[model samples]
Target: MTNAAHIRLLTTLEHSLDSGQQVVSLTNDEDPLTLKDRVDRIERIELHFPHFTDGRAYSQAYLLRRRLGFKGDLRATGDVLIDQLIQMKRTGFSSAVLKDGVDPADAQRQFERFPAFYQSDVASETPVLRPGALEKPE
Candidate 1:
């Protein structure tokens, strides 16, 4: 029921999962909601930004988190940069594979540059200084 051309093009989540690979890739054109029904089988989802300006992956990451409730690793692979790491984290990317020439040390510095966030995102449950903002409460 399968053809070599199709098999060469797409391996599918089911096949990857069965092969013991926990991670999967999603292009910008691929709708994140399409995975909502298959989230359980996905352990990690890699969202490709393609270009730093191409922000469709952020929405994909958001939907994967808030909608599909994907809690596993959300990795930013394509066009990854220090300038976008924070936002990527906010959008639920746990890890990122930066493009060449970007130093990992600089990435860590960027993460530390902002002590708190102003808006609620997947990485932060609440805005900074707001009630119940990363605090146990008095």
Candidate 2:
């Protein structure tokens, strides 16, 4: 919205639809597609996780991707951690803002730890078999 001459800010879901705003900021508990008829207007989604333990953001991301079919930027904000990066990507987060003082290289290694996975995620909505695949959980 920076490049646009006018930026429309809507506080609530109803206000957004009522005002015809394209951008939205959602709390973890709030569904991104509140106004189903105007879902296409959503250009970006920012999921706020108050704490690592508060993983409602993850569910919100999944709903946006699989249910709402949101193709816009799904960003993770607040209390993010290196360990949650892969899961974030799997669920549909396009990018994340990390905490200060965290090493980017070391954090990247966390994603490398798992060469493949069995669960169907946003990256691969259907599970696929890859070489050296981990045994399916019993």
Measured by TM-score, the strongest candidate is 1
User: Worst 10-residue stretch by lDDT in candidate 2?
Assistant: 1-10
The number of the candidate with the highest lDDT is 1
Query: What is the per-residue lDDT of model 1 for residues 1-138, given as tens digits with 9 covering 90 to 100?
Result: 122111111123323343336678899999988777779888778888788889999899899989888977676777776788778777877766656666566667666677686778787797866766577767
lDDT of 2 by residue, 1-138 (tens): 111111121223323344323657788778666846665668777788889999999988888888878877676777878788788888888766666655556656666687567777787766666555677767
Clashes of each: 0, 0
Q: How far does residue 89 in candidate 1 sit from its true spot (Å)?
A: 0.6
RMSD of 2: 9.3
Q: How accurate is candidate 1 locally (lDDT)?
A: 0.70
Prediction 2 TM-score vs. true: 0.72
- Cα error, residue 37 of model 2, in Å, equals 2.8
lDDT score for residue 27 of model 2: 84
Clashing pairs in 1: none
